[model samples]
Each structure stands twice: as structure tokens, then as C-alpha cells.
Target: MPWFPEFSSAAELARREIRIAGQADPVAQYFTALNEGRTDALEVVWPGEVVIHDPRAGVVRGHRELRTFVQDNRSWLAEHEARIEIMASTVVGPRAVVELLAHVRYDGREVPWPMAVVAESPDDRSVVFRTYCSQWPVDGRRHVRPPVFEPGHAEPGDVVGRHLGALASGDTESILKTFVPDGYVAEPIGPDYIHRGADELRSFYTGTFSEGGGIGLQNCTMIDDGVRCALEYNLIAWGTHAVPPQAGIAVYERSPDGLLAAVRIYDDVEPPDSR
Candidate 1:
């Protein structure tokens, strides 16, 4: 017997059908198929060129790989008794970022898994899914993830460009200058590991630079929706140690004065010595 039951009512089935037929938003349709474990419905919405960059499974391209990936993911979720609770979603143009809490019952205990997914549509017929999350909840350990996309240059005039510049320069004051006094930064582990306010932010960055003058960013993609800029990059270097670059994404929200108001990061990148 399947853990998620099939649609129970004709009206519900009708709604699902309508949604799968592209009547609803693409991102919503994708999540619907995932939550309901409906591969058929997924096929109706996904184009032939669909690509999935999963943290655990890696990159899966086309319908065949996607089907297998979805099935495997569904099985894993079921095995852990997992349910997704969407925290927030930000849609800018053809890109959508969704933040979710994966509630799972495992090892006779329950835990919340923090994760985020970015969906980008190049055309109506092609879509890319990039997932970001910590692996600790799933396996009781952390695993390094490969870069999802290649790095590109940041536009010199943008806020992200400025932040990167400050970061690379190891100028703590310059980095802090890019953020509002009340801004907060949430590291990849989760919301509870956030560094809030100027004092906390100063302490965090000071230590970061002390270990390494600056870190290198590769394969950078920036998505801006007026209010926020989402940057996906490979964190290649930290401090003195040069380890394999790992995948990470950070969303930067700007204050009214154009300074960074908040930064939420999602990744499983470990310390240099750990590598």
C-alpha cells in the first residue's frame, strides 16, 4: 500500500488534472506532483528538457532520469516519514525560490530539515531544478556537494558585486558597510545559526577573514527580483586551505537604503581542515 493515498474525490482529481495541464503555475505543479507522488502528473507538466540538480542524487537530465530521481526521492521521504512544510517562496521572472522545512520521523525522534530549491525556466519547454540542503538530518552526518552550476562574473556595479569585492579584499569594514546595522546572516545549517545585528555580524566576518583573506566564488548566477538577489556559487577557497569547491546559494534582501537587510544561506560546505 502506498503511504500517500490517491485522489479520493472527483473534484480533487479534476483540480489535479487542471493543474497538471499547465493551467496552474509551473512551480506549484511541480511541487504538487512531488507531494502527491504522481509521476503521471509530473510528466504532463515537465518538458522533455527538464533538468534536476539534486543535492543527494546529483544532476539528472531529461524525463527518464527525472522519473527515476523522483521515484527515489519519494521512496526516501516515505522511508523517513517526511512531510514538506513550505516556509516561503520568492518568484522573480522565470526563477522561483522556495524555502521548506522537511518534517521527518526518524530514529524514534522527529526533526525539521531545512532546505531550499530554485526553479528556473529558460523557455516554456525547458526547466532546471537546483536543490540546497544539509544532509545531517537524513544521515546524521554532513556530506560535501559538488557545484551545481559553473561560475560567472558578478556585474561590477551591483550590490552583490560590491559585497564580493569587500569579501575578497578582507576589508571587514567594507563588508560591514554593505550591510545595514540591523541586518542578519543565516548560515547554511539553518535559521537558528543566524548572526544578527552589527556586533554579531562584525564578529562573524572578522573570524572568517582572519582565517582566510578571502574566498573564491565560481560559477556564479544571480537572480534579482527588485527586493532580493539570489546568488548561487561554488565556494572554492576558504582561509589558507584550498579545497574542492562546494555548492552554496545565498539570498540577499536589501533594506530601504539599498544595504543588505538579510542574508539566508543554504549549503553543506564544511571547514577547510575537515576536507
Candidate 2:
């Protein structure tokens, strides 16, 4: 079976109970609120608190802010005539990550924007949404996103863990050994930077580890379902240099042979040289 299945539509916002038919994802209510410009449904889904970490809107909390945020987004989407399409969905534990492709008419052209949203339910009442995407599709530059969550002890295991561990070790041979021959790295900015195959992966990692050390990420949360491991982290250091903390999330997909198939990253963190 495929790791990422389509987020089922069988579940309804009005139904709070999780059924064998589908998982009771609060994200459904989130989109519904945005579309209808109403927070009542959202309040029903998550009665206690709704915290959103949005690239454009920053951090939104509580009912009042959520309502305003929803209304504003609804207006913006209506103005831009945005159409969001779900690409894939991965559910693990209490967190569900949904990848979406949104198209908006801009400068007389419809631009495709890719995004991933992590919906984490800590308990039965509260939920947090961390939206990972590049604003470059709309505005031609990367926005520097600051840290959202403090570092925690949520480390990944298995092949996904091996990849991240190799990354921090700055071992090119070790990292390359973890990926399948045809594995690729998909950049967060857009699809234009997909580095595939052994040679391309080697080149990408070589430049990445050139600063004398490997990329260091502090684990904040991890959601793994034995196939795709979704890790939310704070990039604390790159190479020997201790850089400013930046928030990011990555999904590591495992091939059938227990090797990495692909690594999809989502972040707006520009390295020191870029800035």
C-alpha cells in the first residue's frame, strides 16, 4: 500500500468521532472556516484553542484572532480567486500532514504554489497548524521565518533517523549510502531545485557540508507511520557556524527496500551566505 493516501472526504466536520471510514481531522474544519468565513465550525472541532503558524499571517491564537484570520484569508482567497488542490496526505499518531497545491491568478497568469500543513492535536480539544510554504510564488523572495517551537526530545528512528543522523555527521559517503540510487531531494521553494540520482545528491550534500560541519537540527516533534516520517524541527546550526534558529519541517519517504526514496523539505530559512 502507498504511504501517502488521499485525505479521505468521508469524514465530516460535524462528526467529531473518529470512524473506521476516516480519521477525524480538524484540518477539514480549518478549511471550512476559511472558505465560509465562519469560526463556529472551527470552535466545534477544537473547542479549547486553535493556534496557527502561517507564513503570511505569522502566529494566530484564540477565538477572536482565529475568526479574524479566517475572515481575512477568505477575503484574500476570494480576491485572488485561489483554488487549493490536495496533493497527498499522511497521517501518523495525532499529527496529520497534508500537501496542497494552490493556484492563484497573478499578473494575468495562474501561478502554482506548493504547501504542506502539519495539523497536531495534543489532546482532544486543542490543535496547532504549522503551514510550511514559500511565499516566492506570489512575491519573488524568500521570507525569513523565525522559530515556532522550542527544541524537544522527539527523534525519528529507522531509515529516516539514519538520514538525519548522517546529515549531522557531515559524512557524504554515509549520507549517500542511505538513499536509493534514484532518490531525490525536493526543495521547499519550488520544484525547480529537485536534485536527483547519486551524482546530483553527492553534489548537493557536498556544497551543503562545505562549511566544515553538517546541518544540525533540534527535534521538536516527529510523526512516523513506518513509511513516511514527518519531522518538525528548528535548524540551530549549519556547519561549524551556529546560525540563528529557524523553523522547518521535512518528510522522509522510505522505499520498499528500506532505503530512502525522497526527502521533501519545507522552510524559508536562508543560509548565511544567501543573506
Candidate 3:
């Protein structure tokens, strides 16, 4: 038996319940009952009013339609041994989206099919239960696909390395060049404090780097969308134990000049404050 942990938020709790149970799909029995046309076995864990966001059909407003969708999928189970293989799941606010790739095994054939489901809690607190039995097939052959990476996404390690190199060389101008001019650090629980222009950003880096100590960027993580970029790096200033392990995220937006438009930093932000 898997442990179904409860969450403070009702939606999270419900999502957790489904996740824990589906970890190994013990509820295949429940689906077995439904596929066998036993409506009594269709136990709904939904709240009074639940919203279903299906990737194909858009939004389903009530539990009845959701239940009907459940009823509709019963025939597929009769064709193969269905098991829920969760590919990925993300929880945000009072909602969670689950991606499951169902694997089917039957009659000397196997295939895989993908399905996405979204759960929403009416209030911020709600719990849910989910079961699975749909499956397609998984052929024995492997599919090799080309790797996809954004046009210019730099590894956090490389970025940190370059910044450290600039720090070591006392190249304040180079360090400033790395960050978008108007770059601002993503502050926790507060709005960003803009650094205004490149000169200010250069000053900020020059002051921090010139403290006559070995600095390092640790636990660095970088994320980017073609247009904008983000990075979280820890700043450690060595002398006088002056620098704390300040975990901060920098948000960069490009200017028309192809330079950084703004820079902001939330010095008060802490490590655990980030998700």
C-alpha cells in the first residue's frame, strides 16, 4: 500500500491522493469493475462541483460529464491490460495537471498512449481520488528522436563559470555585459526593485566583486524562453564572512538595442522561499 499524504490545500490533497494510488495502479481493480459495466464500482472522489480541463475537449464544467467520460472509456480496458504510467505532473495554486502515458499489453501486442488530466478544487482546499484502466499498446521497438534545445540556452554552470572568470579578472565591464541592463532579481513575496541601467548594474557587480575575497556561484539554475531568461545563483563573499549564501533569481528582458532593458534584485529573498 502507498501512503496518500494530505496537503494543506484541498486541491493538492486530492491530487496527492490520486498520485499515490496511481503510483502502481492498484485501482486497476476499480477500472476492472467499471469496464465490466458495474456502475456501482464507479466511485467518484470529486467534490460537489469539479472542473475538468481535457486537452482535447477543452473545459468540462461538471462531475456528471466527467463521469460520462469515464463511462465512455470502459471499452478500451476490455482490449488490453491497462496500467497508468504517469509521465509528469505539476501542481500550482489550487490546481494540478497530470500527464499519464498508459501502457497496454494484450494478445501478443503492446503500445503506449498519452492522456492529460487537470484537477481544480472549488475552494483552495479539496481532496480527490483517481483510478486508471485505459491502455493502447507499446511495441518493442524504441523510437530515437533528435534532442531539442532552445537556440541559445546557456548551461547554468557555464554562466556561473563565465561570471566567476570575470570576477577573478576584475573585469567589471565583462560581468556587466553578461546581465541584461535592466535585469532584476525575482524577489520572494515582493515586487522587483529595478536597478535602472547598465552603469548601476556595473556598479553593483564591481562593488560585490571588489570585496577582496573568493566568490562562488553555487546551486545555480538557469531557465529561458527564447525572448526572456532567468537564473538563480547563490552569492558567497569570503572575507569577514561578509556575504551570506544569498539565493537570488535574475529575470532578463531584452531591449531594442539587444541589450538588457532592466535589472532588479531582491536581496532579502531566501533559499526556501523559492519553489
Candidate 4:
């Protein structure tokens, strides 16, 4: 069995103890098919509700709309079977958050994405509504968060200095260990995009560091408003295969543990002018 990480909260731990009961029942089978693309099974859960947030296509709501959404991609899901595994689950109050590993296979190729589902029900027995999900990556640099780190925990300048120090040493882990799980990051590059979670975030760093160039930060500043702190810094990219380092401004939101829950990067590092 693949090792699924556990949670520190006892409430979360208790939820994990619930026996999945037995082998997947008909209802479970229906959900599996619905997720895997056999829209035929969707009717089983229909009359209830369904909403899909497609990163590329945007948000889709209702079973009829969902059916249209799925039918529109029948050729896609039909090509493969996607497996969804629950990695970690926690139930608090009437809400249960489940972290999942969704393995997607298409034309014999597989891509795994991590997703979070927040299910809320009047009773703790069955799920009525669920929202939120994303493709998974190994690093956490891709996500950013709103500035929410409480002040007094650490000076913004100190936080900025620490980030720069991490870059100077190429200590990727320490740098990322500073952010919260739902953290956000806004990239500076033209295809401007927002990244959330640690896995995709790591990919951002891997790409930056793998460029065979030494990177550094400058002109860093920090600002906090009770809930989170934003660490703003300039990124210098230059080295072998060295193009001039584009100067970037980064903002980070810190968690209670001092990890970042959000980050934003803005800059213009255009290629050197060629005569």
C-alpha cells in the first residue's frame, strides 16, 4: 500500500478511522465511473447536483450542464480510465476535506494530479456538495496566497532576507517549507497565471534553478496585516547560458508556522536587445 501521510489534528485523525465500510458499493461504482468519464453512470448521482471547474474551460454547474460538459469530451474520457484515490481526509463540523490522487490516463499516457474536495452535508454520512481541485506537481513554488501573515511574528525585511538567503544557497526545501498548503503565487511571465499548492509550486523553482544560472534576490520588503505577511523581493537571473537576469518582485503570505500561504511575482526580464 502506498504510504499516505497523516494529519496532526485529532479530529482529522478520527475521520480517517471510519471504515470505508466494505468494498465499493454500487454508489461508489457510480461515482468512480462519473469521475472516470463514463457519463452514463452520472445519472445515478443526478437530481442532486454537480459542478465542475475546468482550469481551461472555466466553471460548469448542474447535472444537465455537467452532462453536456462531459458529453463534449466523450472522446477524451473514453480513451482512458482515470483512477481517483483518497490520500488524506478530515471531517470537521459538517465539512469534510479530502485530499486525492487522481491518475489520468489518455491514449496509454498517464498524468497524476492532486485535488482537494470539500464536501458539506447536513449529516456526516454522505456528501452533498464538493468543490476545489488541482493538478499536482512535486514542488510548492507555483502557488501564491493573499497577504495574511500576522505582523510581529517576523519582520518583513527579515522574511525577505531569509528568502534571498535560501536562493543564495539553492536551498529549495527551506524556501518552500515557508508557505501554507493552499498558498497562492502569481507569476510575472506573460502567460500570467496563478499557482496553488506545493507540487506545482516546486515545478516553478525546478524550472528557474535548472536554467543553469545562479539566481538571487534584491530590494526585498515585507508588509503584514495581522493575518498574513507579504515578503516582496527582486529576483536576479543570470549565469552560464546566462541571459540578463530579469528583475522580479515577489510577495509572500506567511502562515502561523511561518510558511507561505500565498506569493506573487511580478517582473519584466526581456531578452537582451540585439542590434
Candidate 5:
């Protein structure tokens, strides 16, 4: 059962509390298959090749690999006692991005891990899922993420455009102006890295631009519903150091007054200076 917008109306989707309520969303079904350790449902739904690019398991292709991957992740999920909370979702053309905030036991206590899963259907015959998140919450280490999508030409507008533009030029002050006085920038790791207000954001951006350049991100797919914008991109560089192209997704929340309310990143790209 797929709950695609093409089958349902936008008004109806807005009425639902959670998008994964039924056996609809393919991404939801993927998690269900992993949690329950089953693969028959996935085959029945797509009946074609299913590819998954996970942070830990790497690339899983076909049902054979998916079965093994599901079993392994199920055991890990049970051990961690992950309580997944549904967040917002964005749908554009063949791509559907669903954000999940899961609270899992880590280092002796529960930590909220923000993750996003992208489901792209090239046709009715296949589906590609690429998940984005910082592994720091789970293992306290950042892994270098490989690029998932090639560079795209989706240039966002408004404050998101300003933020990205400022970052591309390494203009710390201009980037800072894109946010409201009390806006916050949250790192992908966890809530522990959220930088709020002007002073804290200033401090964070100052260090961010200390490399003599801003964070280099290549624009990709972006879905902006006027209120919240979800951008999937490949991180290309970190200041002066050229990094391997890596994939990441960011959700930008806009304030009512046209400034950014919050910016949340989900990626494993570690800084060059990180020690």
C-alpha cells in the first residue's frame, strides 16, 4: 500500500497525523521490514530491484542483500530501544523525503537522533533510498559520507538562498543576517549541538568560517512549501580544504517574518580541523 500524493489529495494528507499510519509510504515499509525482519512485503510492493544506501550498512541492492541488511538492523534497533517519532515530510515529483526523530539509548542515556530518508522512484519498477544523519549520536564519531546524488541545479530562493549564498562566499556576517535575532542552527549530531540566539550563532559561524572559506555545498533537490524547505545536497568542501563530495540533507524552517527560524542538518561529513 503506497500513500503517494498522486493517489490522495494534499488536503487529505494534511489531515493525517502521521504519514506512516497505513502500509503506505515505501520508506515506512522499509523500516517495518527492518524492524520485523521481513522482506516479503517489500518484494510484493515494488516487485523490482530495491536499492538502499545506508550510513552503516553501505549499499544494499536487490532483495537478497535487503533481507540480510534488515535482519542485522533489526537486532541493532532492538538493542538500542529506538523509539521513532514521525516528523514532517516533503514530496516533489518522484522523490519523497521523510524526516524521523528517533530517541535511542546511547552511552547510557536516551538521545534524540534526527535522520532523513529519501525515497526516489525512477519508475514503477525500482526505488532508491538514501538516508542522511550524523552518526555522532550513536557512536560519537563522524564518518566521511560518500556522494549519493550528482550535483543538481535546484537553487532555492529567499533566506535559504541567502544562507547558501553567504556560505558559498564564506561571508560570515551576511550568513548571520539570514537568521532572526533568536534563530538557532542545529548540528546533525543531536540537540546537544544546537546553537541558539545571536551570540551563540555568531560564535559558531565565526569558527565555521575560520578556515578562511565557508562550508561548500552543491545545490541539489529542494522542496520549499513556503514555510519549511528541505534541501538535499552534496557537500564539496570545508573552508580551504577540499573534501570528497558527500551527500547531506538540510531542513530550513522559516519564521513568519521571512527570516529563518531554524536550520537542521543531517550528514556525516566531518570537519577537516576536527580532532
Candidate 6:
């Protein structure tokens, strides 16, 4: 016999609606929960297996730690009178990268702190955030941080991987070989410091090698799409000075020929023991 399907009760329907709303854009919900200091809402969007790798708080897993991290972060922002201004956002596949400027009133002066967050959702039930930023803007000094990820080697087929290998080798020709003829590299600090083309890149790489023959990268996490790769690394050593390791993030966009077309970096790491 033909039969009618059972319908959900009003209360059940309401709960389903809430779940659908929460899943609309989990990342947006994440930021909203942080800004509002709403741990309940955060728990709704963050699965039990959620993880956060933060510079200040280190790595936090599970719901309890995440709740504490969120609350503490909110308190810290409030204490510093900090406001986040979103500069840009780019999403590729299941990964999203957001660039923002943290405006904080410190020492009776307002400072713009550059920051970036990479959000990755492996499935509907899991997500992770890797935040990158310089600590100088907040405390007026560099705060050393422990490694967030484990030491790992890059895949051989990746162009950015080859570039990192060249940097570590301190081979100028090898480094340049990974870049296109008209490629450009943007430093962490100023906008006017961009090095473009072969001659300019040669000079920039030379200077970098002069300061530190090779950079020791630790705890690296790379997010690579077909055309671009976003890398987060800890600069453990540079040159002769074995200074405290600092965090840095860089985005490398590749040309059609598989060479690096542009490299953009974000960090506050100065030369070894510049302080």
C-alpha cells in the first residue's frame, strides 16, 4: 500500500534549520564566534576533531582547548583595543587564505600589524587554521614560538619545493633557475622594496645569501593549488647566527612554464640578532 512519509516535528525542524545555517559558511561563522566571544556558536561549527595552530597560543586540539583559545584570544584583542580589517581573501579548493591588518592602539599610538590565516577543511566534519603574523606589533618585541608542524621534506615535483631547495643550497644560479625571467619578489616590510626581473632578483638573492648563506626552515606547512603555493615556515637559522626561530608565510605563484612568477612574503623577522 502507498503510504505518506513521516514528517519531522516543529522542534526537530528548527534544529535542522540551525544546523543548515551554521554550515552555510563555517569560516565566516568561525570569525563571528571569535569576534563575539561566543563559544557555543564556535562549538556548533567546529567539529570535535578541529585543530588550531596559532603563533601566540601554539597548537590546540579538541573542543575544550579551542574554546579556551577563543576566549583568551578575544580577551587579548579587547585588552589591546585591536580591530581586524580584512585586506583580501582568496579561496582555492577547500582552502581559504585571508589577509588582514590588525589595528591596535599600543603605547598611545595606533599600529598596523599584518597578518594572514590559512583555513583548510578536509571534510564537512574537520577543519584547521594556521595563523601567521609578527609579534613585534603587539609587544614591541619578537616573541619566539615553538614549532607548529613537524619537519618534513617537500615533494620533488613541486616547483616551489625546488625553489626552497635552491635557497637552502645558497646557489644563486640554482635559485634564479626556479624563477621566470621577469619574476618578482616582495619582501615582508615595505611596498617599495619589491625586486623584479633577473637583475633585481639577482641582487636581492645575493644580499640574502650574504646575510645568511642558507636559511633553515622548520615546521613547514605548504598549501598548494595548481598555480600557487602558500608556505608557512619557521626561520630557525640564517647565516652564522643561530637566533631564535621566527614564523613567516610566503605565497609563490607559478608561471605557465612552471617557474615562479611572483613571490610575496609576510613576516616581521629581521636579520639574525638584529635586535
Each candidate structure's TM-score, on Cα atoms with residue i matched to residue i, is 0.84, 0.86, 0.33, 0.35, 0.86, 0.74
- List model 6 lDDT by residue over 27-79, tens digit each: 66667767777767656555557788787778889888887888887887787
Candidate 1 clashes between residue pairs 3 or more apart in a chain or in different chains = 150-219, 151-218, 151-219, 151-220, 152-220, 212-239
Q: CA shift at 143, candidate 5, in angstroms?
A: 0.9
Judged by lDDT relative to the true structure, which candidate is superior, 3 or 6?
Answer: 6
Per-residue lDDT of candidate 4, residues 1-275 (tens digit):
33334334554454334213211132343345455555544444343555543433456666666666666555454555656676544444444444455566744556655544443434323333333332223222233221111222323444545765665665666667666777766654312366677887777665655545346444433334434343333344432343432323344545677666665444334322330
Cα lDDT of model 5 by residue, 1-275, tens digit: 56676567765564342333322477787788877888766766666778999989889999888888989988888999987887878776667778898899977899899999988878765788889999988888888888877888888998999999998888978988999999999889887899999899989988888888888898788877788889989999888889988889999989999999999889988887752
Tens digits of per-residue lDDT, candidate 3, 174-252, equal 7677665455432222222234457766665555545444344443434444333444455544422434454433444
Worst 10 residues of 6 by lDDT: 1-10
Q: Which stretches of candidate 4 lie over 4 Å from their true place?
A: 1-30, 33-50, 70-75, 106-108, 121-275
The Cα error of candidate 5 at residue 208, in Å, is 0.7
Tell me, by lDDT, which candidate is best: 5
**Which residue runs of candidate 6 sit more than 4 Å off their true CA positions?**
1-25, 78-81, 85-95, 156-158, 173-183, 188-203, 240-248, 255-258, 266-270
Quality of model 3 by C-alpha lDDT: 0.43
Task: Rank candidates by lDDT, best first.
Answer: 5, 2, 1, 6, 4, 3
Q: Any idea what lDDT model 6 has?
A: 0.73
lDDT of 1: 0.75
Point out the worst 10-residue segment of candidate 3 by lDDT: 142-151
- Residue lDDT tens for model 2, 61-168: 999999899999999888888988887678977789987778888777888888889888888778898898878878888787788889999877778888999999
Question: What local distance difference test score does each model get?
Answer: 0.75, 0.83, 0.43, 0.46, 0.84, 0.73
Give candidate 3 regions above 4 Å deviation.
1-154, 157-170, 179-193, 213-215, 238-246, 256-258, 267-275
How many clashes does the backbone of model 1 have? 6
Residue-level lDDT for 273 in candidate 5: 73
Residue 49 shift from truth in candidate 4, angstroms = 5.2
Which runs in model 5 stand beyond 4 Å of their true positions?
A: 1-24
- Worst ten in a row by lDDT for model 5: 14-23
